[model samples]
Target: MHIKKYFGRMLLLSFLTLPFIQGCAFFDNYARIWVASGQYGTDVKDLIAHWQDYNISYAGLSIENPSALLFDTKIDGRSITYEKWVPVTDENVLMTIVKWL
Candidate 1:
């Protein structure tokens, strides 16, 4: 029936996506490196690079810059921790993530 066909399609889709989800976790550091690449950000990426250069991995990154810069991030370490608020501006923008290694 249509219900069975729909269920099969959903199951197939789940299987296809599961690998990408798992791959991201297995290659978490790659994500950081990609984000920190100076080629991507003339300013904001530099800030991220600074953190990476120090081997400081953050679990989450929050940026608020209506007209300037306000960065809020959580460190990813033995224990996830929130870092102090950072305020600044760099005209931050990730050019394109498509070619990111």
Candidate 2:
């Protein structure tokens, strides 16, 4: 029983530390999104234009929302919807993408 507990703890610790050891790209990508989303007043279109700078790909934009920016991203080798919100014009163009949140 004690051995099982120890193994479980080790497993949890490993998972927690794995990102730090391997340079987690998810957090880095999120940070860029945060910044581009108006953390520093950067435009979202600029973010899309420079996705390659962060090694992230722009999968596409959302049709329903029109302001949602989608990315071809995954974390821990699993698929996830990495969506970022921004403003859009009536013609489907990005407005400002800066919201005070």
Per TM-score, the best of the predicted structures is 1
Q: Which candidate is the best by lDDT?
A: 2
| lDDT by residue for model 1 (1-101), tens | 99999999999999999988887677756757443346545455555565333323222144322222233333533432345533333323321211121
Tens digit per residue, CA lDDT, model 2, 53-88: 332322235443333344332334654445453323
In Å, residue 23's CA in model 2 sits off its true spot by: 1.1
What Cα-based lDDT does every candidate model obtain? Answer: 0.44, 0.47
Question: In candidate 1, which residue pairs get closer than 3 Å at backbone N, Cα or C atoms, i.e. clash?
Answer: none
Clashes of 2: 0
lDDT of 2 at 8: 100
TM-score of 2: 0.25
